[model samples]
Target: MTKFDEQYRDLVFRAIVDGERVVDRTGVGTRKLFGETMRFNLQEEFPAPTLKKLFFESAKKEMFWIYQDQSNDVRLLREKYGVKVWDEWEQKDGTIGHAYGYIIEKHKQIDKLIQGLKENPHGRRHIISLWDIEELPYMSLQPCAFQTIWSVNRGKLNCQLVQRSGDLGLGVPFNTAQYAILVHMVAQCAGLEVGELLHTITDAHVYDNHVEPLKEMLFRPIMRDVKPQLHITNRTQNFYDFLPNDIRLLGYDSHPQIKLEVAV
Candidate 1:
């Protein structure tokens, strides 16, 4: 089993077996665990989930929309990438408001991140935060995988994602793999080797409606022999220039996607 598969299975199992039943903002109740962490060595494997097929391309597009394009326009995602993942969160003005891309762009976080990693590989201050306190009221939905702290050691880039909430059935898979790809992209642009991706979630939950699907996902067999590897083709050294097509997941074999509803 891949590292992601093993860890995800354990998380789902624990959330169902030992978690507390609680009411949430979504109206859909959840079996919640207070905190959880997963570590992935990018050099060992790409950490894509093997039990269920990951929406890699759409996820990549969303990541680019947030970090690279630095845009909050939901229309652009729908029109250009044919991805409507954020459509449910679209505000009246055709944006998700001052969340994600808007905050990143406003602070020039990505630009500073790359510059920091390259200029001072040993710097302790590399971070990108999406949880802007003042912009919370304007956002359609608050950022879940909210912050990333980066560090470079011995020519390798390491990243830690601090997420406030994690919807185990839908969001966690995407967040873990997508951010791992981000580490690869950022490390490439910063001229460093890919290292570890530490994912820390403060509240990890399994929505009541999604429990069955999560169970099914856990029951599915993991493709233990296949090693998932991420391959990236860089046309430019700039991180902002990367498109979804430039990245690919090789040897990624998964079971058919288990349908789960997004508790919007």
Candidate 2:
């Protein structure tokens, strides 16, 4: 079976239905339509997409643009990955304050997170928060309510992602894979084996325009042979030491691409 199969799909489906029902019946117009919780046992599988072709190149480029490049110029993203979603966020100085790369470089947040992991591997409070509430006013698109927590238990690394809002069509797929990779990388640096990834979304919603495509997914059969595996080439203690070549995904199989409208 794929990393995400019937079980995962069912849970998400149920949550969406319940949320929609609540909104329809209670007149709570603000009630969410698609919120879900997912837990991946790392020992069992590396949760990458196997039922559909996941654009690893795009994923890597986006990650690099956000966490590695210290610039917020959406032009770079457009040039490299054809992603110009941040065009409006660009500053006159050829930078954007809200860009992930800008934040990482400006505050050294990733380094701080790594230090926290090394100093207190067993601490329950290990977290790296990307969305700075104070900086929201400066953002082109305020951080979309994403938070990640990493912890160690008996030499295994566990990660939990809490998202207040999820654009399932365009964002969830990439978000899931990126965080999983983050967990893998952190675990490698900490000399710990990757354990589990728990994903919880408070207001996960499929855009109204994506409903038809999702219905199609329910009827389409999943490719059972595709399995995703992560190959890490470096075993360095420094998280920053990791290079693009150091990590790779293997044995991935999936269906044709499905497109959905992004509710920006």
Name the best candidate (by TM-score): 1
CA RMSD per model (angstroms) = 0.9, 3.8
Clashing residue pairs in candidate 2 are 34-204, 66-101
lDDT of 2 by residue, 8-64 (tens): 456446544654533322132322544567788866666765444577766766676
> Where is model 1 more than 4 Å wrong at Cα?
none
Predicted candidate 1 versus true structure: per-residue lDDT over 1-264, tens digit per residue: 999988889999999989899999989999999879999999999988888989999888888988988999999999989999998999899999999999999999999999989889898889899988999999999899999999987788999999999999889999998899899999999889999999999999999998887888877766879789999976467887787998999988888988989898
- Which 10-residue window of candidate 1 scores lowest in summed lDDT? 233-242
**Model 2 CA deviation exceeding 4 Å by range:** 21-35, 79-96
TM-score of each: 0.98, 0.84
State each model's CA lDDT, in order: 0.91, 0.68
